[model samples]
Target: MHSYSRLHHQSGHAAILFSLFIPVLFGIFTLGTDGARAIQDKARLLEAVEVASLAVAGQGSDNVDLAKQYLEYYFPAATIQDSDIQIKKINCEDNDRCQDNESRFFEYQVTAKISQPTWFPGNEAIIGFGDAYDVASRSVTRKYHSETVDVILVADFSASMYNRWNGGSKRKFLDLKDIIVVIADELDSFNGYMADKSLKNKLGIVGFDYYTSRYNNNTRYFYSHLICGSNEKECTKTNPGGSTNSVNYSATVRDIFNLNSIAHTPWQKREVTNISSFEDVLLTDDMASLKTKINSNSFNITSGSGSGTAFYAGLIRGAQMIYQQGENPRQLIIVLSDGEESNKNTTQKLIQAGLCKTIFDKLNSQQQSNGDNVKARIFAVGFDYNVNNNPQLADCVGAENVFQAQNRDDIKNKILELITEEIGHLAQ
Candidate 1:
């Protein structure tokens, strides 16, 4: 009985010891789990920050908000605030201490950070602050090298563009306007980053709805007053003789709703007008002028806005606007369209007469100013449709240079890539 009593006392002592040990064991398990979680959170945060940094790297300080958005998208569950992400444009001069980015190398750095909700104070925990994990990323992107590049935008701002885009309520013209703003900002920023500030890039625009194709041979030129205020007015004078110009897109698209075609006007063949007048701006470094002109009555949905998609007119006019100035200039011609040629004179006859390829080759034939003997690059974008719908785009720029954009956002992203990668590119 005494031995049994001793065993019971020992058992009580062991139970008391185990009760105390249990809290310590539980604490260790909690520490291990939270530590592992903190590490995992940091790893994810680092990846998110890296991708977010790349999105706005070299894009400029104007896009800091954009970086934050990307970070949130990539790491949605994390608790982050705008203050946690810091973005600064490190334009190094002789006096300032720049991190990672060396001004002599003509480069800049974009930095970003993310702090997860703290599980412990950062001082109290190595992996994280309470539950919070901290992660940061830095990216150094090379600035633009010096070059006098000219970008010409040949777009279709027709009645269709005046209609809703992608079946949404927003007009397509507004989207085009937004695109113009993007181009202007990019060009301005490109100039701002150039090593040789003296050589500023130039921009031009040729917004064509329809063109009067002139004939070298019989009925070769299709000219009619494509521009009328509201209804069809007789074109008293034209560059080529006898054809009709259309402002009515419905009649020409040949929908089952309206299968009828337009009436031919004989007076289109009577006289000649300067077709160059159709283009909006010439090759000029004045980006503000380009912006202002695009918003002017010419591009807006005015009473006289032309609705016909004259592919030949836009292509030829763009070529002429660039080449007419000098022998060879570093130029990029970007042609965009939402539809095919709506006229027979420009498509079936005028281009078939060899004028289409002739002008396309002329614009492309110019040698690069650097004496590399490279030709000008032409790129075409078909909005909300395949570029194959517009055969002239392929004929002008080649099948390889054509790209199709699904929507407005795609358009902006694609154009930004074009600006940064083509012609005067930022080196890696």
Candidate 2:
């Protein structure tokens, strides 16, 4: 009877231990499953905040309300608390907020938190912790700032650019001219809004054409400089409240460099030709000079000569000018091409595209000795010419960034999107 009683006592102890372990084991199971699910939800929450930050920064200053909308659109499953989101605008002068030199102008800061019920029984039975888990994230983006930027327009002056017979009704060069002015105006306006005028974004122009050698080697021809006869005046430009007046003088077909005389004639009695190859103007903030380079009569005189780019030289030339500035300001290389006939082979075209990409990679991803990829973004525009069999261009500058505008109106709209979405986008 004593032995039986001892066994019953041991059995009672085992039953109590088993009951205690059941809740502890139950907590462990819930922690493993629900904890992992919470981690995944946290990641989704972070993605929502990141995307919303960019959209709010790019769109405007409406703030937390706008960000919530973006969050709902991007992450509908997230459960947000009323007090869990914050958006703030930062000014560089406020050293407390804009501590880093990179955030030198205006900034948009976004913060978000996701809260959901916790399935872990430990919260109620043992730990007395809250019945929910909070997953939170934050993102900061720059808006207009005091950043100095240099914009280079790498334009195509190929003979094809002078034609209208291919699906296009207007001369491609003229259409390109309208596009150039629009871009310049947008950039200038960006500069105008800057609190510091010295931080003006500069503009530079490059006109490129393909040149073939006697050995059949083809190279890009850059309009390096412009000149005028001792007696003739510079071409007048068409601007607001400005009337244009020009004297008709003989046009000359000089050698590629204008070093040797080839032929002389007059086209509708326009300005004298002192244009030559390899005379690209460096970056400048002067609008009149930029307009003159585009409006000059010789600028439009594209006869049956010149077809030189493997597609990268113009970009390289433009980038070189930016490097010369020494300010390490933000840089943008705007490539303009109808299409190139010289790069006829698919492999050949992609090779040229690779060279262009290398230059772009270098220019956009400039690094300090410590290896901070300045994290700059680049955009490219592709206007449709009569013969744009050069779809290879989409590969040149990411397909999304390339705007294949069919008409003048489309060109303006594309420019608007480029300015709005990507130009000053410094988000990482």
Best by TM-score: 1
Separately for all candidates shown, the number of backbone clashes (residues 3 or more apart, or on different chains) is 17, 11
Model 1 poorest 10 in a row by lDDT: 252-261
Question: What Cα-based lDDT does every candidate model obtain?
Answer: 0.56, 0.55
**What local lDDT score does residue 234 receive in model 1, on the 0 to 100 scale?**
36
Measured against the true structure, the TM-scores of the candidates, in listed sequence, are 0.58, 0.48
Model 1 per-residue lDDT tens digits across residues 1-428:
99999999999999999998866665566667767767776676666655554555434333557877877886676666777667654443431432333222234455666665644333322332365666666655544443556777888765556666572335776677778777887677566555555667777777755543323434533333223324634333442212553333222222111112122232232244322222357777677777776666445644223356666556655666677653334667787667656554445554445544565566566665666543566788766755555566666557787777778866776666565544333443
Candidate 2 C-alpha error for residue 340, in Å = 3.4
Q: Write the per-residue lDDT of candidate 2 for residues 77-196, one digit (tens) a residue.
A: 557755788987665565455444533445777888876666653645544224677778888877655455666777766666766634345677777777777767766656655665
356 Cα displacement, candidate 1 (Å): 10
